[model samples]
Target: MSFVHFSVLKDECLQFLTENAPSNSYFADLTFGGGGHSFAIMDLDESYKLVGVDQDPDALKNGAKLIAEKQLGERVELLSSNFSKFPKLIKEKDPEIEFQGILMDLGVSSHQFDIPERGFSFKYDAPLDMRMNYEDDTIETAADICNTRDADELEEIFKTYGEERFARRIAEKIVEERPIASTKDLENIIFHCYPRNMRFGKIHPATRCFQALRIAVNEELGVLTEVLPQLVELLKTGGRLVVISFHSLEDRIVKRAFKELGGKDSPFRILTKKPVTPSKNEIAANSRSRSAKLRVIERI
Candidate 1:
C-alpha cells in the first residue's frame, strides 16, 4: 500500500501539545512512526521546532519524505534511535533546549502491521520478525521466543502482556509444538490449543498470544516503564506530555505514571482525568485506533 498512514487520536494529541506549548518552543515526537503527528504539530506553529525519533528504518525513510514534502527540514530534526535514549541526545543537541511538548504514540504503527515481512499481523503469513529496530540484534524474534522460552516464561508473557485467560494452555501447546517459525505457525498452534467451538469467538483466538509474543520480542512494556517518566522530566516546566497508548497494559502504565507525577506534591497537573479516545469516524476509518487512549500531563 501507500507509505501514508494515519496517527491515532490525532486531534486530541495535537490539541494537548499545542495548548500548553510555548511560542518558539521545542517539541519531541517520540514515536515518530509516520510523522503524521509531528507534521500536525508543525502546522500549528511554524516557530515550534521538532525532534522526531524512531528506530524503524522505514519510518525514518518516510520521515525524510514528510520533512522534505512539507519543507520542514529547517524546523525539524530526525533521530534514528530509540525514543528511550532521547533524554541524553536532547542534553547534547542543546544543553539548554528543554522541550515544551513531548508526544509518544505508543505501540506498533499501522505501517508495521501492513508490512507483512515485519510479521505483526495475524492476517498475513510471514516470518515472525517483529523488531521495530531491524538493526537491533539484542531483540529476539517472535519465532525465537516461541521455540526457545520455557513454558512458564511463555505463560508469564501471555499473562502479563496479553492477559489471555488461557495463558497456561497456550504456553503448553506452544512448547509442545516447538520450532514454530512463522505467524501462521503460531496462529495455527493457538487455533489447535483452544477448543474448536471457542476458536471462532469475538476476536481471533490467536490475537492475544501473538500480541504477547510481539510485546515480548520487542521488549515494549519494559521500554515504556523507563521512557514515560523520562519524557515527563525532559519537558520544560509547564510543558505538555501527550501519549497515545494502544492497549490496556500500556494505558494503565501511562495512567499510573501521569497520576504519580502530579498531585498536590508532584510536578505535574493532569490535563485529562480520563483518557481521550478516537471519534466514531476515526475508529471506523482505522480499526487499529479502536483501543487507543490519549492521556496528557503538564509539568509544573
Candidate 2:
C-alpha cells in the first residue's frame, strides 16, 4: 500500500528543528504518516537520531521499509503506537532520551483520505469505519457513532468539531436513516440537508460532516490536548516543538497550549507569534496543505 501524504510545512519544520540542534541530537516525529519530515531531517544531518510514532499500521509498515531502504534503521526508531503514549513509551525505551525537536503534523493524513476502504473520504462508497488505528476495538467507528449516538450528541459533534452550520438538520437526518453503512450514504444525507440553492457549492456539503465523524471516531482533539503538554515535557531544555495543524480546532488547541506553556518564568518561549502557513507554491503543489498552520515553541 502506498502511503501518499505530502508532509505540510516541511522546510519550516526542518529549519526550526535543526536551527539550534546539536550534533547527534534526538528528535521525535509524533505523527509519522509518510515519513517525509523524518526522512528530510535524516537527510539534513546523518548524525541526527529520530524516533517516529504512528498508530496506523500502514504508516509503520511503510516507515520500516523506507527506514531500511534509506539505511536509517540504526538512527531512526519507528514505534507502533499513538503519540498520546509517547511520554511513557519514551521513558521505557530510553529513560534519558530527551528530544531536541518534536514535530507533530496533526489531522488526517492524505493517505487516509485517498484510500477508499479507510472510510475517511466521502468520495468512495466504503464502510464507515474511521478508526486511525484499525486494530483498536476500544474506540467506536464512525458507523457505530451514527448508528448508536443520539441525535443531540451527533448534532453537538457535527457543530463543535466540524462547525457545520446545518448540524442539527444533518444530525436529525442521520438518526432518521440509521445504520448508515457507507461513506456515500452519509454523504448523500448531508448533501440533501443543505438548501437546494447551496447544495451544489464549491465545497461538498458532506465534507464537514465527514470531518466531524472522523474526529469523533479518533478522539483527535482530546488526544491532542492530552499529548501537547507531554510533548513539552519530553523536550530538552532548549528543544523546539513544531506542530502543523490542518484545521482551526487543532490550531486553536495548539495556540492555547503554547500560551499556557510559555512565559517569562516558564521554561518555554513561543517561537511564532503568528502561525506560519505554506507558501502559494506549496499550496499549489499540494492542495490539501492549504489549511495548514504551523506554530513553534522552544523550551527555554
TM-score of each: 0.96, 0.98
TM-score between candidate 1 and the true structure? 0.96
* CA error at residue 63 for candidate 1, angstroms: 0.7
lDDT of 1: 0.87
Whose lDDT is greatest here? 2
After superposing candidate 1, which stretches have Cα over 4 Å from the reference? none
lDDT: worst 10-residue window of model 2 = 1-10
Instruction: List runs of model 2 lying over 4 Å from the truth.
Output: none
